[model samples]
Target: MTRVDLNADMGESFGPWPMGDDASLLKTVTSANIACGGHAGDADTMARTMAMAQGNNVGIGAHPGFMDLAGFGRNRMSVPRGTLQNQIRYQVAASVGMARAVGAKVRHLKLHGALSNMASEDAALARDCYEAALSVDPDLIVMILAETAQQEAVRELGCRWASEIFADRAYNDDATLVDRSKPGAVIHDPDLAGKRMVEMVKAGAIITESGKQIPAAIDTICLHGDTPTAVQIATHVRRALEAAGITVQTFDGR
Candidate 1:
């Protein structure tokens, strides 16, 4: 059977501000990328998310981001290779421990926000993050941008990778995401997003902003839990994929 993984970034609630509708999202997505005390999550939020994920019987993955909470980890920092590796290791370990505390195991390591962008484009950063996760737990799968540096590093390091695509985002000519600052960065219409997702998975291609078709591998689909209609988007995508005869599952069998 053809299978696809459905993942969502969870645990993004900061001190007093609640960010995504995680509880409903966790019910729909197969994998939960729990934030590892950086970018947007705190200890309480992480613990709560972990508990909720466990209750819903969902697979767990570590969502490690840069230590920049003010910019929500979207702003890149000029950290050395070694510093990046160490920070990634620390965050992954924290999430690993948190999962183990609740008798759950982290199925993968997914870098978030700026860290994900950097690792996907910079070979050195990709290798650093890949090596750090492998050292921490070689069994953990690495979820990354489909065609970027992290995927390349996964190939070189012989680590498992889940090629991920976004369901509600626009693609540039090069197949990378359009800059969020751009006018048409995100697709807010649920019906349009659902149709685009079906086309992306079934045909394995995305229509770029310039009306060019680019090959896309859809091993996993990501829905930003922080979006206003994240829950509706996920629900619609799941139905569309299932109706098209694709099995929506997590990276690791659950």
Candidate 2:
């Protein structure tokens, strides 16, 4: 049976302001890329998320981004490579500490938001961030955007990693995700997103918005849990993949 992992970003809630429906989304996703302090989570939030993930038997991963809580880490910022490395290290370490406190261990590391976008295009930046994570835990599986510089960096580093595709986002011809501001960039329909994921997994490639095929290692599919309908989309995608004879499970970092 062909197997794939279903993952979602979680623990973005900061202080009194809440974000996604993490409890509901947790049941749908096999892996949770939890936001560390850098992006949107605080120490308490991270502890709560880690505990929830542990109770749900979901794989835990550190989601580190630029220190831009103001923009939710979506706004791009140019920082020195050394600084970026240190920031990632700090965030991952914080996550590790939190997870340990809850008797859970972080199994992977994924770049969040604009940091991810930048790393997807710049191999040097990808290397710096990934290297930082590896320094913290050599066995950490780096979840990277498939067919981009993020993947290239993992290949160069020869570390255990997983390649991912967005379930609700459109991809450009060059394999970068389309800007979210553009029309049709974010697919809100559950059925459409689910079907698209099935096709991409079956083909083992990314089907771009312009109908271009880019062969990639599709080990995991990312579903965003930040929207009102996100859980619905995640449920549909899981069902669609299973209906297509694909087993949804956590990736083994192959």
Candidate 3:
């Protein structure tokens, strides 16, 4: 049977302000890429989310991004490679510490928001970020955007890694995600998202907006947890994959 991991970006709430229905999402996703202090989470939020993930038997991952609380880490910034690497290391270490406190180990590291977007195109940046995370935990699974510079960097590093595709985002022919400002860029329909995922998994490639098929490693499917219908979309995708004989489970980062 074909196996795939279902993951979601989570734990973005900061202080009294809450974001996403992480509790509901935990029930659907096999792995949770939780926000570290850099992007949107605090120590308290990380601890709470880690405990919830542990109780749900979900794999834990650190979601580190640029230190931009006001923009939610979506705004791009040009920082030095060294600075980026150190920032990533600091965030991953903080996440590791929080997970340790809750008896949960962080199994992977995924770049978030603008950091992720930037690395998908720049191999040097991707290398710096992954190297930083691996420095903290050599065995850490780096969740990378499939077929991009991010994947190229991991292949060069030969580190434990998993290639990912978005369940709700359209892709360009080049495999970079379509600009969110464009129409049909961000999928909100559960049925559409679920069907696209099934097709991509079965084909072992990403089907772009122009019907271009880019062959790549498909290790995990990322579902957005910050949306209103995120839980429903996740549930629908899981069910669809299962119905098609695809096993939804946590990735071992082979």
Say which candidate scores most in lDDT.
3
TM-score each candidate: 0.95, 0.98, 0.99
Runs with alpha carbons beyond 4 Å of true place in candidate 1: none
Which tens-of-lDDT digit does each residue in 119-237 have in candidate 3? 99999899999999999989799999999999999999999899999999999998999987899988999999999999999999999999999998899999999888899999999
> Using alpha carbons, what is the TM-score of model 2?
0.98
Model 2 regions more than 4 Å off:
none
Residues 49-149 of candidate 1: C-alpha lDDT, one tens digit per residue: 99899898888899988898899989988887788788888898989998889888888888998888877778678888889877888889888787666
- lDDT (Cα atoms) of all candidates against the true structure: 0.85, 0.93, 0.94
Q: Worst ten-residue run, lDDT, model 1?
A: 245-254
* Candidate 1 residue 226 C-alpha distance from true site, Å: 0.6
Candidate numbers, best lDDT first, in rank order: 3, 2, 1
